[model samples]
Target: MRLMALFAAFSLSVSAQSVTRAGLTVTYRDPADRGQLARVFTVWQKAAQDLKAKGLTLPPATLTASRNASDFASLTGYPAHIAAITLKGNIYTQRLAALHARNLLPYTLRHEAFNLAQPPDLPRWLAEGLARVFSGEAQKDPPERTGLETLSERELDTLLARASGLGLNRVYREATRRAAQRLKQQGWQETLTLTSR
Candidate 1:
C-alpha cells in the first residue's frame, strides 16, 4: 500500500509570511519570494502524496528557502552541489529560484523527503540508494560497469561517507544500482524492513 495512508498527521502553524499544512511548512526570507514559496508549497502537497503512494510517510517538516547560495551553504552546512537536506524536521534548500532554474525543485524535494521519511537506523548505502531510487533520481545516473558491486556493505558505507568528488559519485552509482536491484526483486517496504535490521 502507498504510505499516504500511513504518514502521520502533524499540527500546523499560520503566520503572515509562513504557512503550514499537512505535515509541511513553507517559509521564505524575502517578501519578493512569496510567489515561489507558494508554488513550492503547492507542489509539495502532491509530492508528499506521491511519496505516500510509494511507501514513505512524509513527516511534518519546515521547508525554508534560503536567500542565496552562501546562505544555503551556511544554513545547511552542505556544498553548493547539494540541492536540499532534511534535518530535525527542517528542510533547507537552495533558493526556490535556483532550484526552479536548474529544473531540480521536485526531485530535490522528493529526494530529501525520502531521506526524511526513512528509518534512521537504515545503513547509509541502502538509505542513500533508496532515496535516489524513490525520488526517480537514480534513473539519471550513468551506467556502471566495474569496481563497486563487490564491496561489502561496510566498505560501501565508508566510501559513501568519506569519498569525495568522482569517488562519491561512483559510490552513489553503486548504491543506487544495488538498491534498484533489491527493489526490483522485492519491494521498497520490505527492502527497508529487511535491510534496516
Candidate 2:
C-alpha cells in the first residue's frame, strides 16, 4: 500500500496540465478591445494548431493582450500571455511572456511544453537551441561576413587576424562536426531545457 502511494505521487509529479493564450485574451478585459476578440480567436486557433504539430498540446485558454491574464505573453509580438498553471495537482505558474513571432510560435510552444513535461530538470540554453533547430531556424553558418568585418575593424582585431589565416573550408567542416555532436548528445529534451532558461 505504501509503495502504491509513492508511485502515485511520483506519477502525479511528472504530468501536469498546461494552458497557452495569446492575442486578445487581455484585450477583452477592456471593453474597447472586445470587438477584436474574433480576430484574436482566429489567430490563436491557428497558432495552437501549429504548435500541436510539434507534439505540444495546449489546453483551453484565454487569448488576451493583457499580461495579467496569460500564463505567458510576448511583449514585442502578439501580446498573448498565460497565467494560471496547474502542476502535479497544484498550481505553479505566474505571469510570463509566452508569445513569439508567427514563424517562431510553433518552436516556442514545443520548447515550453518540454519544460512542463520534465519540470525543473532541463537547462534553458539547450532548450532554445533545440527549438531553433527544430523550427529550421538554427544558424547554419558562422556569423555573417558583415559582422565579422565590422568586428575586425572595431574590436577583436587579433582574433580576426588569426581567423583569416584559417581556411574557410576548415572552419565550415569544424562547425558541421560540432553541430552534429551537439545534436547527438542533447536530443530534444536537453535542447528544450537549454532554451527554457
Candidate 3:
C-alpha cells in the first residue's frame, strides 16, 4: 500500500506542469493557476532578497502545489499539511485558495526557504522563530521581549496552551516573535551563529 501511494505521488509530481522563477521551480496540477505561480515567484524573490540583505543565501528549491490538503498530506506524510512544507530541496503546498485562506503561502515558503538556507541542526524554536520573523509575522512585538531565554515560563505556558486544538500556530508565533527580537538585538549573522549552535 505504501509503495502504491508513493508511486502515485511520484507520478503526479512528474506529470505536473512546471514553472521556474528566481532559482526556484514550482509545479502544480493546473496550468490555469499561473497567477498563483506568479505570486509564489514574487514571494520567493522577495524572500531571497530579504535573506540576502540579512547576509544569508537561499538554496535552490522546487515547490509542488498539490490538488488539496489530503494530497499534500499524503505526499509529505504530515497529518495536516497546513500552508506549505519543505523537505530537502522540495516544497509542497495545497492550491491557492487553501493557502490564501490561512494567509500562509509566503510565510510557509519562506520558512522552508530558511531551512534550506541554513544548516539543518538549528533548534525548532530558532528555526520557526526566524521564519516567522522573516515572513513578517513577528513585527508587532518588541525585540527585547522575544529571546527564548527572556521569555517567562508563564508566557511560554500561555503560548503553548490549547496547542492540539489551535494547532502549532501559537507556538510558531512565539518562536517567531522571539527570533525577531534576536534579529533586532544581535543582527542576522550573530543570530544565525547562535541558533546554529
Candidate 4:
C-alpha cells in the first residue's frame, strides 16, 4: 500500500509510563520494555557528554518508544522507515527491540538527542547534517553521488522535511557532508554561534 494511505489507515496513542535512571528519563507503554532503559542509559550519557563538549548542552528530555511500528508511524506522522524523531525536547522511537535487532538503537539515540538539543533556529539541513555527524552515522555513509549539492539551503531543507526511506537517506548523506565541511571550516562554537541564530 502507499505510505500515506498506510499512515491514514490507523491511529494509536501513547500512554505516559516512565523510568528515570542516571539522569535520563525514558518513556514507554509496553510491559516488555521494562529494564530496557537501564541498558541504554549509557549511550544517552555518552551522547549528551559529547554534544556538550561540542557546545550544545541538552535540556531535560525524555526518550519515548512506541510498542510497534504502526503505532510509531501513527504517533509521529513519519514513515516507519524513519528511525526516530524529536519533538519538544523528547525523543520518540519505534520499539526498542526492533532498533536493537537492527543495531540502530545507539545511533538513533545519539541522532535524536542532537535534534532535541540543537539550537532552536538552526537550519533544518544543517541540523540534520550535524545530527548524523554527531551520532557518527555520517562516517558510515556509503559513498554515492547525488545532485543534492546543487540545491540551495531552502531547497535542501524542503527535501529533507518531505523525503522518506532511501530518498531521505540520500539527502541525509549530503546534509552530513555539508555540515561536516562547515564544521571543519569553522570551529564548533563558531559554527553554532554563526549559523544557529
The candidate that wins on lDDT is 4
Off by over 4 Å in 2: 1-27, 67-121, 126-197
Worst 10 residues of 1 by lDDT: 7-16
RMSD of each candidate relative to the true structure = 11.0, 16.6, 6.6, 7.4
Put down candidate 4 lDDT per residue, 87-136, tens digits, no spaces: 76668898877787788888898898788778888898988888898888
Per-residue C-alpha lDDT of model 3 across residues 1-197, encoded as one tens digit per residue: 99999999888655778888799988887544556777788888988888888788898888888877788889898656467777767888777656766777776677777777875666667776787777776664444532345666345545554354344655666677766667789888888878333
Task: Provide the TM-score for each candidate, comma-separated.
Answer: 0.82, 0.31, 0.74, 0.86
Candidate 3 ranges beyond 4 A from true positions: 1-15, 139-167
lDDT of 2 by residue, 1-197 (tens): 99999999877543332333452133222333344434445544664565566555545443223323332333332223323322342222222232332333333333333333332443333333343454343444444442332331113323322443244323323433333357688654443344322
| Stronger candidate by lDDT (2 vs 3) | 3
Question: What's the C-alpha lDDT at position 194 in model 3?
Answer: 81
Positional deviation of 148 in candidate 2, in angstroms? 13
